[model samples]
Target: MPTIPGSRTLSGRVLIIFVAFLIAALALVGRLAYLQLIKAPEYASMAESSRTVNVTIPAKRGTIYDRNGNVLATSVDATTIYCDPTMVDDPREMADALAECLGGKSDDYLALITQDTTFVYVKRKADVNKAESLKEKGLSGLYFLPDSRRVYPYGSSAGQIVGASNIDDVGITGLELYYDDILSGVPGKMVYEQSATGIPIPNATVVERDAADGQDIIISIDIDMQIYMEERLSQGVADMGGSDGTAVLMDAATGEIYAIASTPYFNPGDLSEVEDGATSIKAITSGLEPGSIFKTVSATAILENGKMTPDTEVFCPAYLAVDEYYIEDMHERGDMTMTFRDIIRDSSNVGISLSVDEYLGYDKLYDKILEYGLHSATGVDYPGEEVGFLSDYSEWSMTQAYNISFGQGITCTPLQMTRFYGALRNDGVAVTPHFLVSLPQSGETPEYETEQIIQNTEAVPTMVDMLQTVVEEGTGVDAQMEGFTVVGKTGTAEFALETGGYSTTMSNRDFVGFLPNSTSSLVCYVGVDHVPVTGAVTPIFRDIMTFAVDQYRIAEQ
Candidate 1:
């Protein structure tokens, strides 16, 4: 085969080799042209992205303050410690030290760094001092990540109302949750390079947009008033042998809710010790069977119809007949004639029921209750508000009319009951109850605009006088204050059990009143379970109201 190489066969072989080489070169050129034309832009774009950098910057959340500009909720800088698993040396010492310093730690802190994991969070919400100390201690593989934590100065003081934020600084409850969108400020971001240590390059091209902070919210709530109400209600609930209760203070004229609180409540600052069920605003959001308090409406109906006055007489025999039902009063009295004032002062069940039946028939009684804002949501500023419980008029059972007369059948929230009484206090001018004075615009409507629900301009002197008698001469003397007069109503509604009749263990007790004439100044409602309704709460109402008058500088009594 080698001998023929110099012959024509060798020449032919060389020619064939040359032609194949030329064809291969042409094929390579054509492949390069196809790639350059079709996929050039795509590869160039990917290459550019690999060289570019992106970064994110946190927006500063808005500062929450009280009326006097005291900080309520705030954000403070914190350093989060993270460990690289492949760098730690002493497992036992690190675990013991972390468990002792950070608290609630039961795992090995150093062994975590000995594993294949790249990152491990050791502690959150640590300050510069703590992070510096940890760094100085020289536990390898540990690094600090910047973070922020929410702080509440007042402790558990206004926890439920001022509200708590989520882990990400978003509002979770109370006012925090209510104004979340406004409270959370605009977020800013940055685009830059990162080193192998995962730190951003200093003085690099950082795309920083200054974040806009959240606006200040001025609420109608008074911090001192809330403290006072909490103290008083806490004591009252304990003394009354009740597990939980609530008290609310409001302006009778403006429909401003001043102090609203519920027991078994929690402090937002320290939610760790708080039970799950202890943090709701039950005073406004929960409903209860309002007892004799409902009688005020019936008695008001009697007076409004000119069928009775404070001194108008009704013969009391302790029982009244309504259709097929025989309604009995708690107190069985002889056929003794008593004034309408006497009926209210005594909180007689039969008297009110008969009064409601006689003065205005079933239809009118229903109409007046609806007018007084019962069985309806007041559309208050607070969240989770529920419309009161009242079987519709058309669904009135045999015992419904009489039962509702003494506050047994119908149920209402503390807010609903207070708003109803607020109507009477406002001289029958129904207004929406509110905690905030103003709010940022949502869609087209401004936040918490005040509006009158019903306007009955004339002051019903008879209703005023009767409520006055309730405080000065009736069950509300326990509620009196120094240098002030209060008109109030009390309710002790019986609760039905799963068994039968009613349970003595659970009763919805209430005491509501306002200063001087109900159409003005201050008003409060105390909703206590298993507690006797007394006039003693009148002083609480008076003291808080008078203080509010001075604080807000309202018209002096």
Candidate 2:
């Protein structure tokens, strides 16, 4: 061990190696500390994701029921096919295998797998058997996710009102969309450490977060009545030979929507059948210049003005001159001295105009119109609502003032029309329409029995009496139901476009009445649009109410 030339340098090199190793060890320790302590949560999450495959288990959507507890909408289990490109290492092989089961989308499926994305859904909403078949093949890169497909137990029954859900198992339209927050519950997680063969690893931990399913919705819709309305209105649209139709029912006292049906309705389960017609709730969302249906507003105006009573007399000529304008009826009134009762029953444009001119004046007529819930959204629980157009006076023509009185020159939704009728039924209380009975079973219970939208409705009873005359002896005789002292009105609205003039081609056949033949009872409104050139649907309304009373054992009038 004698120190020689360059021998001492060997020892120095050894020391250098030792120091370098110590420093490297320190650096390694520091990095480990950072990963385990400073950023532990981030790393832990990433590690969890890599070690455990988390699949979504969609919670069952709640069943939707009508007021009588009839099932209108419900949710059932369905499986969908999806692919994880990372899992399916072989693209071409997997795509070809999928094509046989998927039906005519081989290249599309192949292109989908070859994409740079980690997850790609080749198909959704496939039948459970199809997903099971794909599962049976044990395809490496494919996955099956469970979802809830909405089933309208009463197909096209309350299609428009019940609405539809999306591929995500989320509600998209109707009450389904409106109450999504409640109808869509939390998704459950299924996590398991799996081997490359897709089998659960031995002794591996499975972390689970249980999902709470969506709560059921008990709507005020009456199923049997809804069926009857759809049948009747569909017939009415056919009878009137018009294009389309809508019918809405409301509880006069509570403002609950009993039934809202539109034909031809698109299935909430399958949208492929949807067409370009004004089906669904178009009668509410699509506003139109209603023909004689608007005379109700004018009648309200006249009655509010004190210039006319239900029995008050007014003379109607074939043509009445208001300012420089001549207002005429569909049929000549022949200058008859008609009472207000006769005015509505006769549906005399001349008589209504004369009453509007003499009693309502201008401002009073407009105020009465607003009071009756015209020119506003009915504020129902739904998406895509519009406020019916009520042009201000300065924008109004002399003809508009009178035309508005007769249900022309003004625009409204079927829901708004029902509200106007609701005001008449509820003794002047303009009730806002509602769908839900309570909140989700998981959420806080709602304060049931909500109230009214209209403030001053003392004049409603008087209007009801006048409207009753229209049914008892007036123009709405077609709306009367046997064994029921029906109080209602009929409106044959000639459909017109906003930009174009009155439509000579299409019209709205409407019959709205309430039954059990008593006061403080159910009020139903049926408005049919673009009737098929076949026949009248009002009789359907009578049948529906007639059936409703008889079915529910609501005492006959």
Candidate 3:
């Protein structure tokens, strides 16, 4: 056939343009296919977030129980009230209605309802009744979701030890804080579709992940014993009108704490009512000079080194000049010969100082103090435990050494001293004081465990016999129990002034005792601090120990 001069060029151009358009169409189709299939889930989530929100569901906290299966703390059902600010029709009116139903101020609710965001929490864990009241009004944009709040069953009993949790179920103090992660379980998640203005999309697909509840914690405390100690200590503090008082009872062989009580107790249910410095574990945290109670250490050191026997006699002077310091007995008896047992029974400050200095010297005395766990932390399974103070042997002057022998220059916590006495009860095996027996695992019951810190089995019988004499015939006569064969030591020390002296009026009176016949194996220690009255804590100790012995049905002597 025949073609015009320009026809061929124009035909070629038309073919090229057709090819380019066809390639572009195929490329566009391929890209669309890749996006719709390969990237579908990612884009879907992005779009869903624009119209849907993920809400967190808090899991129920684990139950806390005493050794006897009494509930100390637990989580109760509650509801959280929240709002999608964009969906509310009238911000002021909704706020006013919510304020009426709930207890919050109208202005606060009004501010939240007027927010430009998709969601806001009105109350994290509101009472169920309040949430129901709000729901009855059928307020737009507001929703009620299930939640949990911590509740204490026994009021203030064991308050400091069990601790408390926040509104969101997070532990803030005590064992609650110590075991927070184990107590606070996994949080759940839920995704729900909503409108642009934050209204729920009906019949929409909702994704959810169930939360796992926390593990239950079982501790060694006896609830009845805990309540008794708290009551008795509270009364003792009131009667003596002291600044503070602390008591701890433990299993002599196992070191498991049965009851630890402190005056100025707080209500864990309502933390707002806490007293000043009341929430601390004073028995484990507060360290003070332990006075005549420490004479047990001096006597033990003398016996342990064979420097003296129970019948070994020493001259007890009314005053002894050691270096620049003059050590004096509490009473003025002039100079008299006293047996080694008589020193502790009479609580002779001059006797202990002179005897320990002449016999065990400074290094052995300090070593014995540490041997009894007086200068170290008790390693209790509780927070705020302090290591009591003891000066190095290199820094000790003769006077400091003498003072330490009588429990004057050194310091020790109530828990440390309790464990020291506890060792004597357990045949000289010093065990670490602990509260947590075990944690529940795989739906099984928890078991109790014991950890021995030290052992000196031979010295214990002698120490026990001597201490029993203190209660039976000497200064600790106030701690005697008729049938149970109570053995204990007494302490009466002037409260040291922060500015470098001792308080003339206030003193720290302490008593630590144990029942030799009791199979339950109890060691009790009591300290009354900053009390103007003398002989304050020994009687309290006697009463508490008597009650505990009766409660446990310990066999009579």
Q: Pick the candidate with the highest lDDT.
A: 3
lDDT string, candidate 2, 1-557, tens digits: 77689967999999999999999999999999998899999987776666566667677778888878788777777776777676776788788878877676778888988877546777777777767787888877677776666778777778888888877768878888888877788878776575554444677745487667888877777787777777777776666665566777777777787767776777776777777642348756777666676777777666655657778888777796767777787665466788887888778888887788787786677876776667777767777787888888778778877788888778888778777776666666676677777644654544333334344455556766777777777667777766667776677766666786666665666777676346436667676666534344457667777766766677753
Q: How accurate is candidate 2 locally (lDDT)?
A: 0.72
- Superposition TM-score, candidate 1 onto the true structure: 0.83
Tens-place lDDT digits, model 1, residues 1-557 = 46654688888999999999999999999899878987788887676455445433445466666655567777788776766554566766667666665665546554554567555777766776777776777765565656667788877777888888866677888888887777777756655543455444467655667556666566677777778778877877776666677788777677777788888778887767887656668877888788888887777766667766677788777576667767776556766777788989888887777777777777777887777777777877666787767777899875787788788877778887787677776666666777666533332333443434344333255677788788777777776655556678877778777788787555666788777632245668887775543323444455556666666655525
lDDT of the structure predicted as candidate 1? 0.70
What's the residue-level lDDT of 109 in candidate 3? Answer: 87
Per-candidate Cα lDDT values, in order, are: 0.70, 0.72, 0.83
Query: Which residue pairs in candidate 3 collide?
Result: 483-557
RMSD of candidate 3 to the true fold? 2.7
- The predictions' CA RMSDs to the true structure, in order, are 4.8, 4.6, 2.7
Residue lDDT tens for model 3, 167-241: 767888889988899899999987779866566989774648887889898898998988999988888887887
Candidate 1, residue 532: how far the Cα is off, in Å: 8.2
- Residue range with the least summed lDDT across 10 consecutive positions in model 2: 445-454
